[model samples]
Target: MDNRTNLDDYLAGLGISDAEESAPLPPAPDTTAAPLPDAANESPKAVLERFLRGLIARIDPELSVTVRETEEALEAEISGENAARLAGRDGRTLGAIEVIAYTVLAKQEGRGDLRVRVDVGGFRRRQADTLTKLAERLAIGVAKSGEPHELQPMPAAERRVIHIALKEHPDVMSESVGEGAARRLIIRPRHS
Candidate 1:
């Protein structure tokens, strides 16, 4: 009855002094033959999505995540309130998130080849549209003046948009110049 009951006294008091009154031992867990838990069996895509959601929740719990697969990569899009700001000015924050996603994919349990692309509120898509329009406008100017024009150095993704925009053009051709961050595209009147 006291706070610290003696084991022998308690056992005797409970009338459990005989073997039949004692409780049976529970079965031991099967450590070696046990299969993984359901969560551990989740696909790589599911795991990545869960991680992305948790990460974005830190920024704002109201933000929603949508993940899909393309032949080239897993595209994860984040939306809702200040999502563009979350991407940061000129998508610097989004780029960092992308690097983090790729790092996650690299360290995943299975399949090291999967690629991750993190976009915030269609920022990358809109930027691609803007770059494509710029490419088209520049191509027109180059055709008229028969002058070569070089665009300011840009990221490879933006550069690819420019190149593709002018791919079928009659008068201009695009080529990348310089090295590393200094690399840029040159749009010039193609010579026969």
Candidate 2:
């Protein structure tokens, strides 16, 4: 299928792998770089960007798309007035978009996994900051009170932020409990 066809056709850039793990993205788009020999001589990043541009145009003309090839994965940052709306509450909507993007794009014949990541209105960054601080505060409280604190159920990405935030914490540790959508992070005082 032609990627540039429409939003529904190209919203598969953010699908997760079998292990439900995040793939590495790219750095930045090089304007003068030679194009890959794809359907239109465009690289994966180029194709994804073109597809996102068309998607954004349909959603909100004021919004803009910037696709960067990080050393990790293809990062698409959407920004503008209506960006927060697309971001959804706590980035749930953006997560949905990312999942669809990855699943769809990865299944495109020889595409394999495109390693695409999306952030709407910088929601990922801001949410990471908030989650990190919350984790730290809860960890401290758990350590002092000798009690465990179970936070609200969160998605894998959000739970990852909390785990990583307290990875080296001296007094507390983090763990995820429950299953599927009910999975949540728990902070507890270190046993030792």
Candidate 3:
């Protein structure tokens, strides 16, 4: 029994006629979705500052702010307990605020796709140091054993730090994998 005959026998067992099995199907409809806009050109930091400002305005019209744009990002200080509300659960509130700010800024700036880092109460800074150390430790382990090591999931800024810090090490390579909240970094020996 040839392969086609075996397939026919299998389909016949399922009670489908040859005509039905051979029926012409419409070409897989081109379901290609639109591509997302690029994020590199988006000013993620400035948008975050605007969001913080909006939150501050709602909390207290008298509140003032200080906005500082760094070469890599932006920072804003609301200067009171109002900042506490934005801080939210484990800085999650700050993360949400930052995302909203980025979305608004990206759209208003005609950028549909850009990521911005937002931090409140120095949360991201501390996280950077921690991620850097973890990356360094894994770099050593990977260099010694030549086995890939996957770290826990982290937000974008932390992942950036890991990528930057390990990028200079000649013996190791790091890249992010996974998606959404589960996204993480895998450090491994670069191919020779």
Candidate 4:
């Protein structure tokens, strides 16, 4: 026995009657459109603020981020009880978040040179102050002892703070040594 169903029979079986099948499709949507807004024209700080706020909202719905822009950099200050979690241990998580935020903002603005700094509960400021004091004390020790002192491994940014703190010391000098994660700053007596 042969079993063949015509097109109309198939449609009827599926409840799509001939009238509906014969109806013309809605007119094709208009394809022409104006160009997208120039992302470069938007402020980098604004882009960073939007990105950071969205990220923080995922972690703490009640938290808020405040962004400050300067000629040298953009700073995002996270405020809330849960904000400390973003800082992570030793501020590594905060550093990673800053890297990701700056990267995203740079790509969106078509400029990879944008600098963004992230801080949680004033952690970065306090850390910088601590590093500055340590550098001063170590420089004095090295100068008095006429010997070198090697500091514990630190991130590039922290090391930079130490170097800057001792940049003008008359009796001591600072240099970075070691490779990759093991890199650290060294303070030694000035030869002259």
Query: What would the TM-scores of all predictions be?
Result: 0.74, 0.73, 0.60, 0.75
RMSD of each: 16.7, 8.2, 19.0, 15.9
Could you give candidate 4's per-residue lDDT for residues 1-192 as a string of tens digits?
A: 333235335333322223233332222234332222233455787667656754664566667789998897898899788777779998989988888787666656777877888999888989999999999999888988998999889889999999999999899989999999999998988884
Cα lDDT, all candidates: 0.73, 0.71, 0.63, 0.74
Top TM-score prediction, candidate number: 4
Report the C-alpha displacement of residue 159, candidate 1, in angstroms: 0.8
Candidate 4 TM-score, true structure as reference: 0.75
In model 1, the clashing pairs are: none
lDDT of 1: 0.73
| Per-residue lDDT of model 3, residues 1-192, tens digit only | 597566445333322224233232222224332222233343455334434544555555555556677665555665554545556777777776666555555544666555455555566677788878988888888999989998889887778899999998988999999999999999989864
Clash number for model 2?
22
Any runs in candidate 3 off by more than 4 Å, and if so which?
A: 1-51, 60-64, 70-74, 77-85, 113-115
- TM accuracy, model 2: 0.73
- If the candidates were sorted by their TM-score against the true structure, best first, what order would they fall in? 4, 1, 2, 3
Number of the candidate with higher lDDT, 2 or 4? 4
The regions of model 1 sitting more than 4 angstroms off are 1-42, 109-112
User: Once model 1 is optimally superposed onto the true structure by TM-score, how far is the C-alpha of residue 157 displaced, in angstroms?
Assistant: 1.0
